[model samples]
Target: MYRTILLPTDGNPPARAALDRAIELAQTYDATLRVVSVVNLGDAGILSPETVPVDGVRQSLRGRAEQIVGDAVERAREAGVRAESEVVVGVPHVEILDAAEDADLVVMGTHGRSGLKRALIGSVTERVVRRCDAPVLTVRAEE
Candidate 1:
């Protein structure tokens, strides 16, 4: 029943798991996979004035994000699934939610952190799950 599947990746194991799942689902449902990698600019906001060039840091993050999404798209294509990809610079959850507007389903990876650790380090997947309008399918990373 899916026409478009959204896959967000950061090149982490959990993201990789989500990629595999997304590819499979796309193949099954004859859907197109939209792979996206977000470059979080929040780190730049937290840095001191003495840090290295902010432009250089942003370029680096953008490069990494492009590589991540490009690789994910390649993997999906090699698996015989139609895929398109993009690199966005913004809050991870916000960008993902925005991209999800045109998607039939969203498949993402959850780090599966809980309790104190999860409280201290907020979860993007959790935030997206709470606010996303499309159906979300989360793949947990293997420990």
Candidate 2:
């Protein structure tokens, strides 16, 4: 049984699909939903002088995160689910794992990218699944 469900979104198509599933599950179980969007801090150590400034990058990321989570929260509300949203700036996987402490379950979407692409970009869902103490439900993006 789930009382509080955490759904992390990035405004990606896959994430939207996962949000729908999370909402359906929340409704079925009479649970509250908490949507979170993490703004990743890009590589600070290796940035060249010609690269975009770190502060500018962070601001852009934060703005996008806010927009994504706000939209997801509105959708959840429209579905008659009690929903709250938060935007955090940090490592995605670490923030998600920390959030799981207060949540009964974490529902996330997987892009299903593999090999070098997956290794370079990494998989937040996989990291969350491996590290979070709470139950994680991963929904792969539909083809």
Candidate 3:
């Protein structure tokens, strides 16, 4: 009984796996797919003396996000599903949770990290899992 499905991707292997699963689910349920990629501009705390061009980095990241969402939308369309894409600027998990508010379900890929590695790097999928209200289907990457 899904009308809208949210697929959040980072263009990684695991995210690709989730994308495949999302396509299948959308096809089966005749649901509209909403593909999204979030460009995380870091918190406002860095006062770098090294003249790192902040604007250039943001632009590059935005371009990559656009390409990623665009490609996913194309694939979904080719699979005969109604699809739309969005490139958002914010924290990955936060943006995903916000986007999922209008969707019936969220399908995401898990990076499958654990222990210290997971703690140190942090897991966007895990954070989404913890805070998301919609039903989330997490697909793990092939190792």
lDDT for every model? 0.92, 0.88, 0.90
In angstroms, give how far residue 131 of model 3 lies from its true place: 1.0
Question: Residue-wise lDDT of candidate 1 within 35-107, one digit each (tens)?
Answer: 9988888754436485668887788888888889988888889989999999888899999999999999999
**Per-residue alpha-carbon lDDT of model 2 for 115-136, expressed as tens digits?**
9999998898999998888999
Candidate 3's TM-score reads 0.94
| TM-score of every prediction relative to native | 0.95, 0.90, 0.94
**Global fold similarity of model 2 (TM-score):** 0.90
The model with the greatest lDDT is 1
Alpha carbon lDDT of residue 33, candidate 2?
95
Best by TM-score: 1
lDDT for each residue of candidate 3 in 51-99, tens digit (9 for 90 to 100): 7777777788889889998999999999999999998888788899999
Give residue 94's error in model 1 in angstroms. 0.6
Q: Point out where model 2 deviates above 4 Å.
A: 43-51
